[model samples]
Target: MTADTPAPEGVRLQKALANAGVASRRVVEQYIVEGRIRVNGTTVTELGTRIDPENDLIDVDGTAVQLDVSKRYVMLNKPTGVVSTMRDENGRPDLRRFTKDWDERLYNVGRLDAETSGLLILTNDGDLAHVLAHPSFGVTKVYIARVSGTVTAQTIATLTRGIELEDGPIAADKARLLDASRGESLVELTLHSGRNRIVRRMMAAVGHPVTELVRRQFGPLHLGTLPAGKARELTKIERGALLTLARQDSQASPGPEEHSMQENE
Candidate 1:
């Protein structure tokens, strides 16, 4: 085995928890402080304790802890007006709304605004989440926006060139007007920056200004045919592609739900 791969036997409780990709060191410490861990039928409360995972009996919250080989990934077609959070004191936009019947405990990889809608991915893989949502991961976001005022050829250039805002300069890696009316246009924007309300703020910084913003893609995953308020498991290919994307540097790409129209669109 490579030196980086720890031997399967004689690993410690904290190390096992971390190795199983369960919790961080600080969080596992809290479990220890709460006396929530057990070894060979005895409560383990010491923070410095160690035990072998392969041979020793380990339990957390009275449930045996086993290393997991499979990971769970979920893609939700988030509708506008629902908050994108695990929980809130105001009792709104809790993830339970969409995951009511799912067996897995899923958490959003990142977040979308309550006023925005489109692809929102959830997963039980903390390491994958770190790779997707972490800014340093540089995961790309693809958005479709409806904006006021005509998007002149020059305006599209400003988007490509970058615009300065109170939060600092923001620009799309690439963008184009997909549909246009007299004074409004649907624009597809792709970028590696996942800043808050970035699509809206970016358009406002320029002259067009967004009236409605919807996410169509995040990395290699798409909202696909999933209806709003409903969810589905990631296809084998979807799961494989995400791991593939994580291995490479970032790039602009589309996944799904380019706009928040009825499914017919």
Candidate 2:
């Protein structure tokens, strides 16, 4: 094909978008005419546009779209005592109890200790999974912990300022005391570290032991009113937000190879 020729090797844009559940084929055609769709960062108004859905970056109204229909993303409000592993050798409560209904073999992104419960993502999309679970991406997570004793302003300050642990020094991105009583305190903390039991460890390091902990948010996903032990597929908007986060992170921080190429250039 010549430089000016359009490659006739892929499916029509409208059909591909429709099959990906973006919308009906007819609506996708209208979107094309309205210039609301973009492929590979270029707006395409032609209805005859064909795209390789697997390789092309497609966006609708600036929100990244996941065109692979085979990928499944599930949000589970993991209840305390349930292990994050799909299968546990100890035969205790595990994620398989909740995910067995889905046909795709899904695995948890990152993990939550058996004692700590909150938003857990189960997905089969390896690329997105790696982007989220990898510490290099720095996806933030929010947790609310009820700890022993009253949490003073100094304690909150120390958490954000930094603290030393056995593994290494760690700090919360944000910290605040939600409620304080005579013998207990409710504190909210935000951190991007994926350290094992970091919240519990941090609180203990600061002289307050965490009595109970619940993760309320993970990156763009929230556990809003999701009752414990319930699992549901992510909504379209949630998936878009998640994909946008991953895309933005991947773009902002180039891989080692990309950095090397840039240096050479």
Could you say which candidate leads in TM-score? 2
**Residue 263, candidate 1: C-alpha displacement in angstroms:** 26
Candidate 1 C-alpha error for residue 233, in Å = 0.6
Error of 1 at 189 (Å): 0.3
lDDT of 2 by residue, 56-147 (tens): 98999999899988889999999989988888999989999888779999988988888888899999988888888876678888999999
**lDDT (10s digit) by residue, model 1, range 1-265:** 9999986555567877877655787888789889998777688888778786545656666554544435677888888778777787797766678887667788887788887888988888776676687655567778889999878778888898989877577678999989889889999999777566778878877767778877888888777667877778776467657755653433334333222211111
Top candidate when judged by lDDT against the true structure: 2
Clash-forming residue pairs, model 2: none
Question: Model 1: clashing residue pairs?
Answer: none
| Cα-based TM-score, every candidate | 0.67, 0.89
Poorest stretch of ten by lDDT in candidate 1: 256-265
Q: Give all candidates' CA lDDT scores.
A: 0.73, 0.87
Which TM-score value belongs to model 2? 0.89
Give the deviation of candidate 2 from the true structure as CA RMSD: 6.1
